[model samples]
Target chain A: MDKRREVAVLSELDKKLINLLQHGLPVCERPFAQVAEQVDSTEDEVIAHLVDLKERKVLSRFGPMFDAVYLGGAFTLAALAVPEEDFAKVTEQVNSFEQIAHNYRRTHYYNMWFVIGTESVEEIEQVVQGIEEKTGLEVLNVPKLKEFFVGLYLPV
Target chain B: MSENNNIALTSLEREYIIATQKGLPLVAKPYHAVAEQLNISVEQVLSMTKDLQERGIIRRVAAVPNHYKLGYQYNGMTVWDISDEHAEKFGQMVGNLPFVSHCYLRPRFLPKWNYNLFAMVHGKTPEEMHQLRSQIKELLKDVLVERNDDSSQNIPTQSNDMLTSTEILKKTGLRLKDKTA
Candidate 1:
């Protein structure tokens, strides 16, 4: 986790670009130019700052935020409480599946938490069953009953 | 819309998703770059993307910054067991908080697990994370349940807890398998 941390000191321009672009970029031929106009900067300068941010690992992604569920897919948050000795092996078995989109090691009794993304809603159950069989662990499959909000706007 | 809704993706749409899933090119004409790759007209690419967004497929065309790199080093997946009757009301209130990035009401597995409300919060330090957690607790104080003292009960002893991530085992964003391969 420490190795992945590259704390970049963001400049005023970088912060402005991030805070503005996060809401969304216009879906036009020259969106950057529009953003530049809003920020009182040039299109090339905005592009250069964004490129630098991406390279510095500050920007994880810069594109369309697709909704997997809307795209005829399903996603569920699942957890497994693997034994200490089998942690490494269990992580490998669980992650081998392409369906596992994001996996995290959390501080909890049921430590190994991951999100399963499948092409269809019904396949979510199948993936859960597969992971349980492969790891010999009980999976706590928790799908969202109601989504209150999901807009991620972190002001830098 | 039902979660089971099967909105079939056209072959071109699938190709477009595959082409731009990594990210759009940083150029004067980003859509044109994707159009060139798929051998489709620039107008077609732009129109398809707009259609997808209008259909609620694409949430937004945006830049997602790494929170940790931006000094938000501490992130806690705060879970709570709130009254089902007032869950929706309280969920909305908690979700409206600026610091709360994601808030959802999920099912609980009784006996072992009991948290039905999950809200992810981030902070620059552990102290800040705790403060945010406290703010959430204060917001849902009325709806939050107090665990029964009876040892024989099949419910968890605690009503809420924050599970901070220790490591990112895998961080690959969603990927669609190339069926043609």
Candidate 2:
């Protein structure tokens, strides 16, 4: 953890920017412009800061938060226990899909866990099967049996 | 809104949501910033965001935790060997608890493992965490607490990615030391 990157050391303006990005992108045609206006800066400045933020790695990828159910996209959370030797190859294959958003190699029996957001349940299952068949690993379909309130709130 | 409604998302929408999950725009018109990036009107952003929230597509958009910094010193990932018949009942009941932040069911790795229900709890210290666990125990005494067999290791990779990292997990506390790993 870069002490410098610690959110506390940031300037109020930057803090506000972090807070803004934390909640979401401003909903406006000229969002940066709108944010610029709010922070009393130019739209260009807001965009620049975001780019810098990404460079710093504080902000991961910047874009959209999809609602799979709404847009009719079928998505699922799946995992596979890839042998340590095969981890790299399996990951390369899994990440190959545009549907794989976030993948994590965690410590569990079923290790290389990933999320796939696609267009339909059948399609999602088919993709899962393909990954398993190709990787020669069991892909566990741990779909959310029940939707629970998943809120990541860290009081700033 | 029948909270169960799953509205599939557009590629553009998915991109924006992933980006913003870190945190929403703090600007007075945060939605406007999003609209600008998407090359759409602020009004459209606001309307869609509202729809997402209403549809439970995007859960509450808010600030995430720096657990260690916040003094939530202990975290525990508790699993239950719940029978399939009552798994949903147990999961939903446990999920609704204020302290029980996250609850979910995963396919059990049988022969070797059979715990199906998993939950994550966070507290200021080991004692606090233990106390919370006891409370959970009293509530779930009927359900058998699965023996934790996995060695400690995992987190921060996910913790490092705050927004999209909000899934209910199974590690907490001194385990947080392993978090940075």
Candidate 3:
């Protein structure tokens, strides 16, 4: 938690506004105006607050969240257990792929977990195999068989 | 919803997705600005967005807060080894929890891995996350016990491991229909 990067304080209105925006923004011509009415602020004020929130790093991003699967793309959660000495080299090799959307170092034997997204299932396999060839570590490719839910609701 | 519609996006829809994948304009009239950029009507932009949402191609147009920046520093990828028969019911129950962000039933590779259900949890601190983990453990205790009795293998009946992220190696939004193959 870097104090300099985080927002020092959130006004009551900002809190309420964040809570409202999480559900979603209206899809219309005057969308901000609609949000303004609900949050009891002017349209301009709502837009300004959104900009300020993003700049302060409170909001990582604000936009349409597209589903890659629906768009005919494929993705998988894969991991590798890199030896302590080769961690840096392995990380560099794994992240070199543009298709590797996200990679995280977790505290476990299979320490390096990452997501691979590509145009199709074939591409996903190629990337996974390529990773194994590059890192000399077996890749644990776990594709989601079923999504119970993706409701990422964190109460502000 | 049928995830694989196999219906191709119209040229207009393709343009819309490519334009907004970077994110909608953070202005009062975001859609209008988008329409202006694409030389399309504002109504067409609104209608297409609605259609995409209905089709599940677009999950939502909303504010994605930085959980770490918002005081949620403790996040864990909690993995559980639920029996195949009871996974669906249990996974749904875990997904419904307010603290669980994303829950999924993924394939488990034998010997090295046995966990099938993955749930992501975030909290203000490790202590807070521990409390949430306890709640999850309590919820799954009964099923795990039942599973233990049915199994004849020498494997211990222990369940669940929380993999806390030590570092974020790389992160970037997936581009729409990226042709990097």
Candidate 4:
């Protein structure tokens, strides 16, 4: 909701650049250099524009998304409903834990949602328990009963 | 896809990403803004991100979880118990449904925990959600599931307690970090 932000107008040139980048930067030491040649921008300009778009929050992260299962661990998507008065304190505490990923304040009975990424199912279970003793409120551990393949992609 | 498929990355690159995940910056040249912070060439930042996408490392750059504005204020989890053999197929079919937001297959303890196929349905009202789930249930041809007759369907109970109080606290179990006001 920042007014200083710019709108994403996909020019043909910009679209082509994004299309090539979307396919992925090749696996190499100098990926931007390659993309630059393809996008008709110098490597410096390509990186500069990317940084700009990222600063504007157009891109989520410019890094690999992990496969938790392959990393010898699993996670559960969970939430809770903290009282309004205690929300800020809980947010600070919730945000402190690296394993919790990030917590968001949503509009619902179960609103204070956070993700748990931990080693082993046992660890995952333990993390959930630890969250309970720390906070008096009950936590709704909504573990996925099944898996669905989803990627964060938007056709700009 | 696999851990072995992973390529190494630098710390600065990781920092650049974490700062911008929530939203993009505003400027005629936002890339320059980000580059200035990192003290790197603007082109490097763009290509680093572009490369990450190509390598399948970064998924995409976009805003997320704006569900509130989307009018899906009502959302609930729906779990199922399809036979193991049919679970995978059922998940694919269930995920394809427009009403189904998420679907997953998890290990069950059998007899009691037969509902392995899970999907989430969001609607304006509880009844609307039920209707959508009911429709998806019909698509599970060979899949047998224990659905609620008296109440809404509960996830196959390996644990009868749906609100997992014990496990939830563990993540925040550590000492609270100091906050600078």
Question: Isolated chain A: TM-score per model?
Answer: 0.90, 0.67, 0.91, 0.71
Give candidate 3's whole-model lDDT.
0.82
lDDT of 2 by residue, B1-181 (tens): 2212454567666655644655554343556666777788767776777677776666544334454443444546555666677777877877776676667676665444455666667776567767766776666667654454544543211100111122322221110011112
| Cα distance off (Å), candidate 2, residue B174 | 31
From the highest DockQ down, the ranking of the candidates is 1, 3, 2, 4
Off by over 4 Å in 3: A1-8, B1-7, B145-157, B177-181
> Where does candidate 2 stray beyond 4 Å?
A1-67, B1-28, B32-52, B63-78, B84-86, B97-102, B106-113, B120-139, B145-181
**DockQ measured for candidate 2:** 0.14
- Candidate 2: deviation at residue B111, Å? 4.4
For residues B22-75, could you state the per-residue lDDT of candidate 4 as single tens digits? 334422345666678778887887788677666545555433322322233455
TM-score of each: 0.91, 0.56, 0.90, 0.52
lDDT of each: 0.86, 0.57, 0.82, 0.55
Q: Candidate 3's residue-wise lDDT over A1-156, tens digit each?
A: 446335337887788878888779999888899999998899999989889988887876777888767656777889998999999999999999989999999988889999998877778889999999999899998889888777566676
| Each candidate's fnat | 0.75, 0.17, 0.74, 0.10
- Preferred candidate (TM-score higher): 1 or 3: 1
Q: After superposing candidate 4, which stretches have Cα over 4 Å from the reference?
A: A1-74, A77-115, A118-125, A129-146, A151-156, B1-8, B109-113, B146-181
- As a whole number from 0 to 100, the lDDT of residue B161 in candidate 1 is 94
Tens digits of per-residue lDDT for model 1, A5-89: 7577999999999899888999988899999999999999999999999988899888888776655578889999878899999
Best by TM-score: 1
> Could you give candidate 4's per-residue lDDT for residues A18-97 as a string of tens digits?
54554444534455677778877787777777665555545433533433343334567766678878877777666666
Write the residue-wise lDDT of candidate 3 on B52-142 in tens digits: 9998778998888877666777679988988788888999999999889888889877656778999999888788888888888888876
Number of colliding residue pairs in each model: 0, 62, 0, 51
Better of 2 and 3 by TM-score: 3
